[model samples]
Target: MNPIDTLNLDFRALSTFLAVLDEGSVSRAAVRLGVTQSAVSHTLERLRQALGDPLFVKSGRGIVPTRYALQAGPHVRQILDDLQSLSAGPPFSPATAEFTFTIAANDYQRDLLLPGLVKTLRREAPGISLQVIPSGIPSAEMLRKDACDLIVSPHAPEATDIMQRGLMADRNVVFYDPDYRKPPENLADFLKSDHISLVFGTGERPSFEISLNARGLTRRNVVTVSNFSGLPEFLRGTDMLATAPQLMSKHLLRDFAWVPLPFELKPFTLLMLWHRRNQNDPAHKWLRNQVNAVAAAMNKLNP
Candidate 1:
C-alpha cells in the first residue's frame, strides 16, 4: 500500500483506535468512550482507511491487535500522556494529593531533616507519601531518569542537567564528652586528644581530616564509624573528640560539648537537587516549598 499523508489524519481517530485496542470490541469501546457503537465503527473504519491496515483481527471471542497496532501501542500511549500533561489544569492541592514522593538521601541528611518533613506531611499533606533511598555521587543520573523526585546531599551533582540549591551551610566543630575530656582550646590539645573518624562514600579520609593532612596536620583517631548518628553513642562518657558539622552536632549538644575547631575548615553546604524537567511542575513546586520551609525552621534553631 502507498503511504498516506499524516497531515490529513484526524486526532480523534487515534484515540478511537486506542480505545478499541484496549476494549477489544467496538461495542465495549463505544461504552467506554460514551459513544454509540455505530460511531465507534465509523471511527475505526476511518482509521483503517487512513492507515491502510486492519489494526485488529477478530479471534474466537475477541479481537487481537495486528503487528502494526502492537508496534504502535507504545508511541500512542506516549502521545496520549504528553497530551494529558499539556491539558492538565487541576490545581495542586497537597491536602488532597495522594502521591508517593520519593527522594534520594544519605543516612546523615535523611535522619536530620526527613523526620521534620514527615511531621509536616502528616499535619499539612495528610494523604502524601514519602520514600527515602540511599544516595551517592550518581544520584544526579537517578534524578535525570526520574528515579526519585529529589536528592539531598552535601556534595553537588556534576551533571549539567541537574540543578541544585543550597538548603543550609554549617561549620565543622569538635564535639567531646565533658565527663572525660575538655573542649580542645588550642592546636596542641586538639592533636593530643583521641578522636572518632567518620568515613563516608568513596573517600579514604573525611574532608576535615583531608584538609588537616594537606598541611601536615594529624589527629589520633581512636574510633572509626561510617555514620554521624553513631558518634554520640561511641563518644558518650568517653574522652574521644569527633568532628562534625555544627548542624549535626546541635542535636547531640546535650550529650556532648562542642567548641570551635582549632584549625580553620571550610563550611559544608547541604544542597537539594532536582531535574530541570520538574522545575515548572506545580506538584513539584509545592513539594520544594514544603522542604524549603522545613530547612528554614532547622536554620532558625541552628543559627
Candidate 2:
C-alpha cells in the first residue's frame, strides 16, 4: 500500500480493526466498541479497503486475521496508544487526575505496604484509586501483555523489556504455634520435622530449601499451601513448622510465637516491575514512587 493511502486511514477504522483482532468476532468487537455488529462490519470493510488487504477472513464460526493483519496489529495498537497518550496530555498530575491502577502483590506486601501507600495517596493524589491483587513469581510475558499494571515480586525477572527497581530486602523466619513444645535445636533436627511450605509459581520456594540443603539438611516431608496468609492458621496447633518472610510474619503472626530459620537463608529483595510501555507515563511514575516510599517506610519501621 502507498504511504499516503495508509495515512488516509481514520482512527475509527484502526480501532475497529484492533477490536476485531482482539475479540476474534465482529459481535464481540461491536459490544466492546459500543456499536452494532453491522457498524463493526462496515468499519472493517473500510479498514480492509484502506489497507488494500482482506485483513481478516471467517474461519470456523469466528474471524482469523490474515498474515498482513497479524503483522499490522501490533503496529496499529502502538500507534493508537501513542496517539491516545498525545491527546491525554501529561501521564500524571497529582492535583487533578483520576486513575485506577491494578497491582499484584502478596499478603505480606499488602500488610507491609498498603497502609503507608493509602496514607500517601490520600495526602498526595487523592483522585487516584488502587486495586491490589496477590502477585505470583514474575513472568515477563504477563508484564509485557499488560495483565498487571505493577508487580511486586521477591526478585526481578530477567527481561530487558521490563523495568525493575529494588523496593526492600526482607529476611525469612521460621514459625510454629506458640504452645507447641518441640523446637529444633539445629538445621539437621529441623529437617526431621514435618514442614509446611508456601509455594508459588514454578516452585520458587525450593531456592530457600536449597539453602537448608547447603547446611547439611533438607525438608523431607513437606505440605504445600498456596497463600502466605493462611500459613499461620495451618501451623496453629499442628506439629508442622513454616517459613515465611520476616516482615510478613511480624505483621500477621504477632500473636503466634515465631523464631529465626534454623539455617541461614539469604534475605530476599522485594522489587517493583513494570512494562516498557509505561516507561514515560507520569501517573505510572508517581505510583511507582509511592510504592517505593511505602517500602522504605516499612523497612524503617521493621529495622
**Models, CA RMSD each:** 12.7, 7.0
Judged by lDDT against the true structure, how good is candidate 2? Answer: 0.76
TM-scores for every candidate against the unseen true structure: 0.69, 0.67
Model 2 ranges with Cα > 4 A deviation: 1-88, 201-206, 213-216, 220-222
Model 2 vs truth, CA RMSD: 7.0
lDDT of 2 by residue, 84-124 (tens): 67776754688777878888787777777777887888888
How well does candidate 2 score on lDDT at residue 285?
Answer: 81
Tens-digit per-residue lDDT, 1-303, candidate 1: 455664244457666777777667788778656789999888777667778788888899888899998788767756665665676589888889898999888776887788889998999898999999877654555775577999988877675346788898878888888888678879999999888998866544567888899999888888888767678888888888888877666464556778988988888888899975566678888888888888999889877
Q: What is the lDDT of residue 263 in candidate 2?
A: 65
Best candidate, lDDT-wise? 1
Q: For residue 38, what is the lDDT in candidate 1? A: 95
Residue 160 displacement in candidate 2 (angstroms): 1.0
Q: Lowest-lDDT window of 10 residues in candidate 2? A: 1-10
lDDT of each: 0.79, 0.76
